[model samples]
Target: MTASKTLNVGDKAPDFHLPDAEGRMISLSDYRGVPVVVYFYPKDDTPGCTAEACAFRDQYEDFKQVGAEVIGISSDAPDRHARFAGKHRLPFVLLSDQDGAVRKAYGVAATFGILPGRVTFVIDRDGVIGHIFSSQFRATRHVSEAIDVLGRLA
Candidate 1:
């Protein structure tokens, strides 16, 4: 696999289309003119992933209040995503990056070249990346970091 260049603040957020939990296509471009929080996680139902997802779900209203959308991406299949979301009552979108293409495009490195990396990107309404937070272990912090950035973007 080709190594994806690490993206940074001020870079243009890469556009992507992936299936949501329901097998419907969702595109980054579809949220144009609206800020978006895109988070990459390792898997669904795992402890760390679940904590990160639920953290986002709990703060989902704050994101929406700021006119931002929260989206979670993982390599899991759509069916798994559906079950995970339903189980946790996640209020945001969970996308299936079955082939890891979108994750690579975002340049989310795997932790120690093994587990999938945990990273969060905040994209402005114009589609420019405004902030990026990467932490392999501190999952819940991703939500607060994204919210803090969005608050500043307001």
Candidate 2:
């Protein structure tokens, strides 16, 4: 399949329908009319991924206050996502991208052509991307960057 161009700020965020931790179908359209933070991580329960997930968990209230939804997506199975979320007490949704199709649709590239890319997209209420941050190592910063952009949108 041909690769789509990487999405950028001002572009329309691609709409997707995926299953969450409990196997409940969740669509990006389900969250329209409110800002959304969609982060694609490498995997569930890995050291860096855990740190990033926990960072979002800690500031989940801040995101909620602004009426923004935070979603973490990885190729991990729904069961592992459920475990990861439960173990960290995460209050946000974690979606499973089993085939990495959504990842490619969003143009979340791999690091060194191997590992899944750690990228975060901040979409405004109108479903337009407001900001995009990608960093493989500084995973926690994705949460901060997303929150910062969401604040500006608010």
Candidate 3:
């Protein structure tokens, strides 16, 4: 895969329309005026991805309480995403970016020599990136850190 233009803090998130686990179309514009935590992962139901998803699942209520919405995106197809979300009981939507359009747009697609790096983009109510977290193993911390940042903004 070619290197993609990485989105940065304070940059407006690239708008996208991807099918969720249930095959319902979702878009960044739909959530305008709401803080959003959009996370990108490698695959659905994989060990690392599960950990990351579950971490967000565990924190779903807290996120909603803060007036934010959390959404996970991966290159998996909608059917795979459906099973994964059902199996894990994920509360938030799991977007299917099967063609990697959104994944590449975010610069998180796997490249020649690296596994797809995990990335989190925290968008404030005005739709500007407030924080970006990149990690593999300790993805749980990303959720915590995002909550902290959102709290400060709140």
Candidate 4:
């Protein structure tokens, strides 16, 4: 039984308050007035996931210049997340969903989806979801596409 709804474009983004690597609580509501790119991945350290993270890291400034924040979410524990972030020098926050609550809430939590299929949600400043990208091969491009979509919306 999947708890995720088929989130549509323009839908209100589901609010969440999860802990970051440093154990700081990060909430979706906190970024309400700014465009947000929330991406879900499977684990902390992996090839595809690493590529995806590095891609975002590489363009971290572009997203910021465009007035957007990127957040990566996964079921990894805080310790693992901390290691991954430090290893990659990721500038964005990576939320820890240890129990998969956030994942299930977003409907991307899957068993076979072990290597969580890439799902990126681009949310507008008003906290409304503007676009959803569901593709693994294009995971690295998710951030760029999200910035483009959010730029148009802005």
RMSD (CA, Å), each prediction: 1.4, 1.3, 2.3, 2.1
- How do all models score by TM-score? 0.97, 0.97, 0.92, 0.92
- What is the TM-score of candidate 4? 0.92
Off by over 4 Å in 4: 1-3, 109-113
Q: After superposition, how far is residue 110 of candidate 1 from its true place, in Å?
A: 0.5
- After TM-score superposition, the amount by which residue 110's alpha carbon in candidate 4 deviates from its true location, in angstroms, is 3.0
Cα lDDT tens digits for candidate 3, 28-142: 8899999999998888878889988898999889999999999998888999998998998999988988778787877774634467768899998888999998877787787
The C-alpha stretches of model 3 lying farther than 4 A from their native spots are 1-3, 109-114
- Could you tell me which 10 consecutive residues in candidate 1 have the lowest summed lDDT? 1-10
lDDT of each: 0.94, 0.92, 0.86, 0.85
- Model 3, position 126, has a per-residue lDDT of 81
Error of 1 at 87 (Å): 0.3
Candidate 2 per-residue C-alpha lDDT over 1-154 given as tens digits, one digit per residue, 9 for 90 to 100: 2355778899988888899999999999999899999999999889999999999999999999999999999999999999999999999999998988899989999999999999999999999999999999999999889888888888
Tens-place lDDT digits, model 4, residues 43-152: 87888789999999998888888899999999888889999999999999999988877777777745464556578999889998889987776668887787788778
What shift in Å separates residue 68 of candidate 1 from its native position after superposition? Answer: 0.5
Per-candidate total of colliding backbone pairs? 0, 0, 0, 1
Runs in model 1 lying further than 4 Å from the true structure: 1-3
